[model samples]
Target: MSSSVTPATLDYLAQRLDELAAQFPTSPDAVDLVTLTDDIGTLGHHLQHAIERAQERFTAPETVYPPERVALVRLARAAAGIARALDTLAEALTYATTGFQREAVEDLAHSPLRNDPEVLRIMTAEKYVAARARLRHTAAALRTASTPAGSSTPRTTGLQTQPAAGPQPRQPNRH
Candidate 1:
């Protein structure tokens, strides 16, 4: 399948990963889980291809030199490590995603509607469904938000909707 991810994009991602490696990584509430997990999975798949290529190169006739063949093995191992690193990244993102969702829901616990019959009913039911709905609702808002993350005000609850008043008819353009 064709990919929009180019060699340059991977190279840049490598560079960014290298830059982030020096930092102490612990940010629970900072969630980019949606894209990061998918990206990491893609990167791991890319590394799997590289690992296979290295194995093929190692067995090539021109690679008869033992040291050169060993180098190919090392290359494959390093690519395998990249997949492991991607796994670590995926784990971190999962933690952040969970943390963010939990925090958002916990905040909802303090809302005035907490004692409302409908709200209490949802709380009493299977919470995973509610948790997922909260995450999806927040994700949709965040994607379309014009303002900064935390600063964005709640527009609607559970689902978004246009005002009951419909849109005005569009005027034809005039020269």
Candidate 2:
């Protein structure tokens, strides 16, 4: 299975895993763990799409006569592992959240950003608006980079890319 898997596919899978690992908190609370679950889910979704794309490419009639069934099986197993891991993490988060005080949990749910005044300020600033536009542009470039060669359009994932409805009213500097 390892032999049949392409280097590019493995690299992308490893990169995605690295991203997930980087998001892991050393001493995570219920909220952090829940956020990790969401990140893991997104990674799993992207990995599934990548595996499907690879399978389609390898199984195409124009290429090799015999398909690599072992590689496909390995990919499928990896995807299942991802799903199981997410489920387990969610269960753990549920337990953690249950152990916390109801009011604390409610606070986490209602206003996670309330503790970080700088984040709130930055989020409303004109600079953040410009940075968000730049981020969107960069995300578009990354989508292009991940696209398979010879494909006309970039592959779509669960991520959405909607334009802002109107200009944001920038808050005055509060230093």
Candidate 3:
């Protein structure tokens, strides 16, 4: 494979991950949390596919494959981690919503008034607030984990070296 092609492919994969990360809901509702979970799973699948493709590409002779493979594997792991985080967030939301509803109903049943719309509404709102906070915290943690450590410096993968800064003197074209 041409050197140019490998970096382009990696860039595409990185862009896709960025897009998925951006789609995470800042204030996720129950329905939104479910959708986000599914989306995160899908992103994980895509990352896995990328890793497989990178491995396959490695079979080509005399090509720089090890570094690319390492990078792809790292990305796949990050994607899986993010998906797990999203799953945790989804579970927390489901639990909060259901537990709150159950407790509210049970509490109301024991009271003189069996059904109070205002009380139910207040409980639901409180549940939503608490769940939203948990989701935001989980999302923040996922973002932190997904980012590569020491990202301030360019990563040196395998035998490839960074190109020197400034414009290169052009080589004369051979007739």
Best by TM-score: 2
TM-score per model over all chains: 0.36, 0.41, 0.39
**Ordering by lDDT:** 3, 2, 1
Please give the CA lDDT of all the candidate structures. 0.37, 0.39, 0.42
Q: How many backbone clashes does every candidate have?
A: 0, 0, 0
lDDT of 2 by residue, 33-97 (tens): 33544544564565466466556556543442222333344445555545554454444444444
**Which window of 10 residues has the lowest lDDT sum in candidate 3?**
166-175
Give me the displacement of residue 76 in model 3, in angstroms.
5.5
lDDT of 3 by residue, 5-120 (tens): 23444454444445544444443232243453455455445545544554554565345335444455554554454455445444444443455444435564457443444443
lDDT of 1 by residue, 1-175 (tens): 1112122223333443343232212232222334344445454554655555454444544523444344344444445545556555554444344442343256654566634444332332223223223323332332332322333212211221121222232222211
Model 1 CA lDDT for position 95: 38
Candidate 3 TM-score to native: 0.39
lDDT assessment of candidate 1: 0.37
Off by over 4 Å in 1: 1-26, 59-62, 93-175
Candidate 2 segments whose C-alpha is farther than 4 A from its true place: 1-5, 29-34, 54-67, 98-175
